[model samples]
Target: MIRLMFLLPILLCLGWYYFLRVNGVPLKQGKRGFIYILAFSTLVLGFFVLMMHLTNPG
Candidate 1:
């Protein structure tokens, strides 16, 4: 479970990267790309935080 908490976000990001490439999104060259990267980063960070909170005792 602990390992999964770290792996899940990486897997999800890879999937998302594949999806973007399949659609030919310019991942390296524009404002749109930056937005997508920013959003995904935020999502991954939030997921990790949530997992940590769930696994830790107060």
Candidate 2:
């Protein structure tokens, strides 16, 4: 369960990259895309952690 939390963002970013590549998006050409991915992944991870903490505060 904990491992999945970390892996989920990586998989998401890979999928996002593939989607962008397939659609011929040029945003990945600059740091903007990388920053977006990082921000998105961080949000996802933080959300998961927050939920887990809220549910299992021990």
Candidate 3:
């Protein structure tokens, strides 16, 4: 379940980028890079959230 949660964000981001590319939307390189970073951050945040809850499991 934890791995699935992390993968969800990444897959969604990839689908979004693919949609944009297919539509021929010319996104700036910086913006594209930021999106990738944000997607990865989403995955990291999921991990942190899991850890936080586990640490305080009450």
- Top-TM-score candidate index: 2
Which 10-residue window in model 3 sums to the lowest lDDT? 25-34
lDDT of 3 by residue, 1-58 (tens): 5546666666666776787688787666436755776768777887788888999958
Q: Report the C-alpha lDDT of model 1 over 1-58, residue by residue, as the tens digit.
A: 5446556556666776787788887656444644666677678778878988998988
Score candidate 2 by lDDT. Answer: 0.76
Better of 1 and 3 by TM-score: 1
TM-score computed on alpha carbons, candidate 1: 0.49
* Top candidate, metric lDDT: 2
- Runs of candidate 3 with Cα error greater than 4 angstroms are 29-58
Off by over 4 Å in 1: 1-29
TM-score against truth, every candidate: 0.49, 0.58, 0.47
Per-residue alpha-carbon lDDT of candidate 2 for residues 1-58, written as tens digits (9 for 90 to 100)? 7677777667767777787788888654744666787898898888888888999958
Worst 10 residues of 2 by lDDT: 26-35
Ranking by TM-score: 2, 1, 3
Cα miss at 44, model 2 (Å)? 0.6
**CA lDDT scores, all candidates in order:** 0.67, 0.76, 0.70
- Candidate 1, residue 35: the lDDT equals 65
Q: Give the clash count for model 3.
A: 0
Q: What is the lDDT of residue 58 in candidate 2?
A: 84
